[model samples]
Target: MANVEFETLAALLEREGALPSDRALALLREATRTLSDVHAAAILHCDLSPATLLLSSDGRVLLAESALARRLGEARQPDTPATERIAAPLYYPPEAAQGLPLDARTDLFLLGATFYHAMTGAPPFDGEDPETRALQYIRHEVPPLEQRVPGTPVLLNVLMQKLLRRDPAERYQSAAELLEAVERTERMLQKRQEARRAPAAAGAAATDTPRHGKRPRARQSTAPAEAPAERPPTTRRAPAKAPLWQSKPLLYGGAAAALALATLIALLSRGGDSKPQATKPPEAPSTASAVAPANTPTATARKETPRPVVEPPKPKPKPKTSTAAPPREEDTPPKPQDPPEVTPRRWKAVQGAAAGTETYEEFLKRTKGIEVVDYEDYVVNWEYAGPYRDPACAEKCGPFDNEFPPEKPGEKPDWAPLPKGADAGRPWLFNFRNITQIAQVAADRAAIYLRTRVYSAIERDVQIWAGSDDSIKIWLNGQIVHSNRRDRAVRPDEDRKDVKLRQGWNDLMVKIGQGNGEWGFCLRFRTRDGEKVEELRADPAGK
Candidate 1:
């Protein structure tokens, strides 16, 4: 009744030829479960009209008369068991009022009636009035399904007929059994379709090679004849007259001239019998002078034979002493050495005001590195000695104070007491919402000390955001609390459980860049309780 919408089952059946077998069975099962869970005695009355059965948007189940009973009858009269009874205003069968015991099969019969209408896009029993349909449901037999809707499966038709039997005992025993029969029939039909398609696909693949064979053979036959026809004309025009350099006779003549010159040189080299003039017996033919006959087959053998022995000249050593000295060894350079390491000084300063007669106004103007030394468990004393390491704080020096009120009315305020041995120096404090900047924070054993007050009571939980390029440690009171030595972003939100605050004043001390940034740090706090707090501005006047 709360903006409920209805869609007729007849429209769905007409659009999608028949309900898928699985979907139909699933609908029936879900309907049974819903009825069981609601403790409905039975879905006693049956309405078989095309418009009465409505399929829900999920397409899983039909919203039968139970939803109507709950909306119209039960909602109006909460105490009455209207959903259990078949009353006039809620639902119509007067016979159902006679107390016929209903069970799961009664609901299955109604589902069968819905299925019949869905398959045919029309009710099993055709009647304009509800009374007529009710009478038919009780007495008349459903018409043969195939006669009304041709091509309906024989199994489905028989199932519908069984469901419409006048006697409840003659119908399918339960919805589950009816659903099983429909599923078996659907599977058989699907298997048959797949069997028919398989052979068709194989035949298509078998015909593919023959279909492409003709083109390749036709190209091969025409290619050879075309190549010969294009080649003859190019060959005929190639030779006009050969160049002299390429003539065969000229080449042979040049080779003969070269051979004759070589023979003449060999004769001249064997100087004509010169031994007669000297009158000495002709020396035996020297081994170097032996020559082989041109036609001898032993000429190659002569060239390969070993000649008489000859010794090579040996290299002589120089005299032992020399005037010049040997070149001195080249001078070698020395290896470079590594640079020395610089160890950083830790935070040793205390937190609070310096000891002097200087006014609070003058103390605020001085920019110096202040040390916060923790003496007791809960107290941190601070002192400012001189300017910060930064060039901006050159010669400034004054007394620093964080105490609440002045000692006398309208008189200069007293400086907060410092822990013993805390030297006065420039104090570093950074403030921003979401932006980032750099500041030099120096201290001894303790980290850098930050002195600030929360203006308004933060009604909601908040986070203090802090980060540094080097090592950093944060303290709320004098206690050394959160530390991030890994040089990563610091989020107090992650440690929100550890942070505690009163309504008025809150102090934060952070030591960062221990040896690096002169212990530099940058931090801010933000609320995380889903509400933004109006933060107090930095008030030098209040101090």
Candidate 2:
């Protein structure tokens, strides 16, 4: 018995749905050779399906040659063949289903069905139940390739049809014939690809100038005052003309336009916040970073490997460009995160340690000097603080944990553009990707101050699940909705809370307490019956 271990092609197809044409062709090529070798041994492989053929990521195929094959007598015949019909109904041949005599062509029919499924994402007999599927394979005709998969190559489609013919006499007589057909189609495909690339490469080289890096400096003529009298006559290259697009005047104009466009884009992407962006501010005692501006990333918690920044050439008339201004930072485009489904909302968070009503009290009395927090209408961006004192208001502060929905925001610096790439280093919650998970300096105990406006198209019951290290407190639309202080490892939906969401936007905030080990929280919204809140959208433009 030929036994080999590898991922099965059927499993691969199910995982990836369907494969590209080139990859599918390569798989079929290996299958052809493996089947041909098995048939040459004068043994009929009665069972052939994607699952029976082991495949590898690096493009190798092995057929499971077990009870599937029977030894042939003289005249190349099986005296008593296996009649168990073990192949999948999707790939089962008509003769095999009817318990009729089978031969090499039996493998071809099953192989065709496999290829059909690989390219079309559906089996030849795609009926739901086993009985309906088996009957379809026995009687249904394979649809034309165009009908099932529009762009399949006609030659490959033709080969598949010939292999799938119901009559054994009409199908390819042996595996060797099918192999030849695959080889021919591959060659034609190779030629077509080369033909397509030939003109495209030439055209791009001629028209598309390389814009990857800096251009070369201009070379100046250094002819001496006295030329060599006996120098051999050399062709004097007439002063090489600059490319039309590279003329000094035109280059200057283009440079200015590009610089202005970049500045405009940067401002637009950051939103219309004009707050000062200090590199670092005086440290303050608070949860989250006390003095860090909204634009500032937690330098103590994370750091990216720095690259040398190079300034671009300035237009000739413009003053020398600033070497200190960041060059590489602007090049990194912001990634678009898909909004969470269940927790019909999104949040922006600041980190804190040992978060509780005391932290909230200090944040309120020390900073805002207010009793209640209306976070929805909160107007200022507060500097992040650790699980300590509020820097702005000092230790002499009051708590507002009871104020479920604070009437407004607390002490905060100027509102800067929303944090970009703040969640760079850490992994976000699986379902709630919009909310970033920030690491805390203290391992076991930390808290985050988060705020967001959650809107729903209709009023419905929404389930909220949160996981924390030690304890957690959440405020929904200004009401303290959830409070859990038991210490435990963080996991998704470790603590579930169900609440009713009114139609339109609702405010939500949370303070997660950390005691030891990994500390962070995950929150999301789902329906009453564990369905996603599909009608939810956060901060949508114009509702």
Candidate 3:
């Protein structure tokens, strides 16, 4: 009921890190939907401040004293006690309410208001007091969403503006529509987050390796060259540095070479001592024995083993340095997925007047041929002459008094009887049946005419029923009126309402045709105010 209470709700949400409870949120959602669907004319919450909402154990719901609930014509007192109050009333501008019927769109505005308050710490239309806020809701324009929350999606902002439109028709037609827009905003936000993180992850990977690479290289380059020889003794003393053995490829290679040399020396000593002492000839043996002593078996073995050890050390160190390159390659992050292109689709006008197709290409072709009228809200209006010319059919074929009786049984008229003193004669009737003609204009712009004359000084009303696959426009007495192009059937009886009539002779013209489906027109008129004058009738024979 007060701003203080609204502040309290905010405090609670901040502390909890979420709305009061799922049940409360669900109740609010359902209530919002109900209000939008049934009372499209009413604004659910005239004052959308935090205090109007009550968060109970069950969840969050509107308080009875909330301006919206009161405006909705609820009978409950503001102070009435309840476990939960789910609905609020809304106030509508009298003119807008009278002109257009309320529908679900009205409630969507409230929902948006609710979301705005929840996300921002303030109401969308903040004011000094409840009365001021109500006035702002009625007259003052709410600030753009960016002003409230920076980086809001344009689509979301536009949707909120539409929901809060003064005219109900301009708002979303139902709660479902508003929900869809909300869901889309959520998806867009998710995609944006993904897009932002992709580049960040790649950059992080790029920076990581250089930081890690510098440390190891610095330690290795600063270490003493004699560090290798000291490593084996250090490993024997402390096993903790045993892992360092794998790192000392050069030291390991030297140790392997020393062990191989010792083995080769032992093998040669056994071979020489056991072999030729007895088999040598006197002069040959003397030289061979002297050579063997000079070149001892141990020394010969050491030379051969050292040669192989030197080669192994060289290749072993090369492979270790080569192995380091793969880690650097591994450290390089995989390429980031490219962000999807976000191309916004905007509404554009396709055709101009002059009986041309409204397709995008057709609209382009007629650029130089017709006048294009631009209306508010990006609506385009065009006019073109129809395709059909007057037909040369015989005029004087039917008698004026000829009445074809009803075809079925029990399909009687449902009209109120004439008042006591009223003088009522037979009603004048005209029927145009079984006619096929095509206008020169494209099918979307065809016009059919039913010409007739009326003789009366009194008030008269006429109704025209027409069906077309594409579109239809009806006019009486030169006034451009009654147009239907929606993707629904056009019923003559239900669609045509009462119209004023003029005295003396008059022409009733109806232009109807299939834009895409079967095309036909039907009309009926009755004199409500004046006496019918027989002399005023135009004779078809004379014409």
Candidate 4:
């Protein structure tokens, strides 16, 4: 492999201060599209920060550092201690800080924070200590982008807010969706840049004419005699409609234009036989005579509008009439249309769908199979028991590894299944909710046992994904396959374990111990490659 060097976006920002809106937008679009690709492959860029964005000497923007990337729907490993998985607080999501299970949306939050830093040259939630920063993100809303940097585009500001939403459900559900939003904001940013440039360009061109030493009268004298009036009629009519109550200048200005047009036409008719002399000084007809030339029969024919009659003399006007009334008429009509030249309508903020509550089933349907684990697609039945409790056990300390059919109430000596509800006066229960709430077992600091007989067509290695409140332990065909003794809220697919299933029927059992609040567990199976297990059947009765 070649050692190619590149500058981190963080360093680039440090050297350049803050990026221009257009530059920031281009970089954001590229980074978002790259993230969309990563998500397409069922991967999550858990660590998205300015430091992870690289700018090549060739000017291409890239997302680098895949070390923190994890498979879609995967969560922090239970076997790994919490201390080893500490994330940089600046870029990690609120869910990560709270120890909740993560998915593709988690990365979207980080991406938003990273870009916030890119635009303002500082993290949205900044602190010297990781704990303080994490607390800030978890408990507080990020200040608006405009508040941090005045005059930031509103569309971009709103986008940053949506991406950094405290609730994952409020954020864009997929990278593709977020990419669409970014492209829209980028286009608006481009329109604003072009709008600002248009007026400056027009002003610059106007200034250049003065430097060329050509008076306004010289420009009028040089115009072709038969030149067409390309000016639109609306441009001329717009000024006449303005009321004097709006401004005294507008009323006086309209009257002055009418007088200028009348004076210009009369001069051309009387001066038809006279030749222009640059050395002659103006007397009573100073404004008109200064501009009239050696006029021809063409000048005498059309006297209605001053434009046609005055244009016939292509080269005689001099600097003496440069500030005359005729030049003022040409400038009046354009004032109405000037505002439209720098149109800011294209920079209007784009509105997005408002956030609302959504069911898990609705989410699955809307997102299709991407990023989320659809437990209902793979497994539909689970036989469960208990709200079993052992006086010797505390919160996460339970009879997870003890022998089945405990000698006493909630008692277990070693690794085995506990007594089924049928033997404990609670009888067995069943549900197909994907996530069995185990609400029937209402007691806190209790345990629930879930079992199902899974039939596979052939012997193969497969994966079982499970989640539970408080703590959970799983057994595959009487062998302990996975166990996580941590107190936390449940999320689907929090733990994935690979196990061998026999050619026929196999017993799958689960022990979930609850501490407080919600009590539930969800389980599903798939091929080792994370595909649906098409030839599997679930029987709560072990048929």
Number of the top TM-score candidate: 4
Which segments of candidate 2 are over 4 A away from where they belong?
1-5, 72-86, 200-543
The best-first sequence of candidates by TM-score reads: 4, 2, 1, 3
Question: Which lDDT tens digits does candidate 1 get at residues 156-251?
Answer: 667668766656678766655665665666677668767777877688788776777988899898788679777878677767788999898999
**Pairs clashing in candidate 4?**
401-415, 402-414, 403-414, 404-417, 421-427
Q: How well does model 2 score by local distance difference test?
A: 0.59
lDDT of 3 by residue, 407-469 (tens): 124633222211111112311211111121232233322333333343333455543433433
Whole-model lDDT per candidate: 0.44, 0.59, 0.43, 0.67
RMSD of each: 29.2, 32.7, 26.1, 28.9
- Decoy 4 TM-score against native: 0.36
Displacement of the residue 61 alpha carbon in candidate 3, Å: 7.9
Off by over 4 Å in 1: 1-59, 62-99, 200-543
TM-score for candidate 1, please give it: 0.28
RMSD of candidate 1 to the true fold?
Answer: 29.2
